[model samples]
Target: MENTMVFEEPMTAEKCSGHLSSVEDAIYVIGGKWKLKIIIALHENGNIRFNELQRIVAGISARVLSNELKDLELNGFVKRVVHAEQMPVVVEYISTDYSRTLKPVIMALSEWGRKHKKNIREDLF
Candidate 1:
C-alpha cells in the first residue's frame, strides 16, 4: 500500500484573509534587514557581548544594533543575560528556542537566494 495526501484548491476568502494576517504578523516581527542578520549571527556564535555582536553582524551601528536587540528580546526571539555579580558587570545575548524555529526558514531562503543570484548572473551574460 502507498500513502498519499491531497491538497484543496481555491482557498476560501476567509482562509486567505487569515493567512494574510498571519504573514503580516510574521513580517512585522522579523521583516527588517538587520533583525534576521542579528538573529543569524547570534545563532552561529552562541552567547556574545554587544560590542562583539556588532563586530560579527558587520556594518550595523551600535545604535541600530541596540534597538534591534531590544526588539528581538521583546518578541521572544532572543534573551539578554546579565552577570551583575561579576566584576564590571557582564552582559550577553543568546538566541531563544523560539528563534530556533527559524532554522528551516533560513535554510529555504538561503537556497532560494543562491538560485536567484545564479539565475540573475546567467541572464546578465
Candidate 2:
C-alpha cells in the first residue's frame, strides 16, 4: 500500500489572507525587470565592482541599476561594501545569505520559463 498525505482541514480565510500577504511581500522584494538578473550575476561572480556588474547585467541603464542596487541593499538581499584605504575608493556589491534562499525559486522559474517559451513557440507554429 502506498501512503499519501492529505490535508485534514481546508485553508480558511485567515490562512488565505496570510498566504497572500507573504506572497505580496516576496513579490515586492523580488519583483522587477532586473532584480533576479542582478542577483544571479552577483551569485555567479561573487563580489564585483559597480562598472563590472553593469557590464554583466547587460542592457540595464546606469540609473536603473543604481536604483535597483539601492533597493536590494535596503531589502537585505545584497551587501554594498566600500574600500576607502586606497587613493581611489572602491565599492562592490555582494549577494547576501538571505538572497541565497532564492536559489530554488530561481531554478523553478528558469524551468517554468523554458517550458512556457516552448509552449508559446509550438502554439505560434
In candidate 2, position 37 carries an lDDT of 98
State the weakest 10-residue window (summed lDDT) of model 1.
Answer: 1-10
lDDT of 1 by residue, 17-111 (tens): 99899999999999998999999999999999999999998899999999999999999999999999999999999999999999998899999
What is the Å distance of residue 26 in model 2 from its true position? 0.5
User: Top TM-score: which candidate number?
Assistant: 1
Task: Kindly list the per-residue Cα lDDT of model 2 for residues 1-125, writing each as its tens digit.
Answer: 24654557887899879989999999999998999999999999999999999999999999999999999999988999999897699998999999999999999999979988998999999
Write down the lDDT of every candidate, Cα atoms only.
0.94, 0.94
Positional deviation of 43 in candidate 1, in angstroms? 0.6
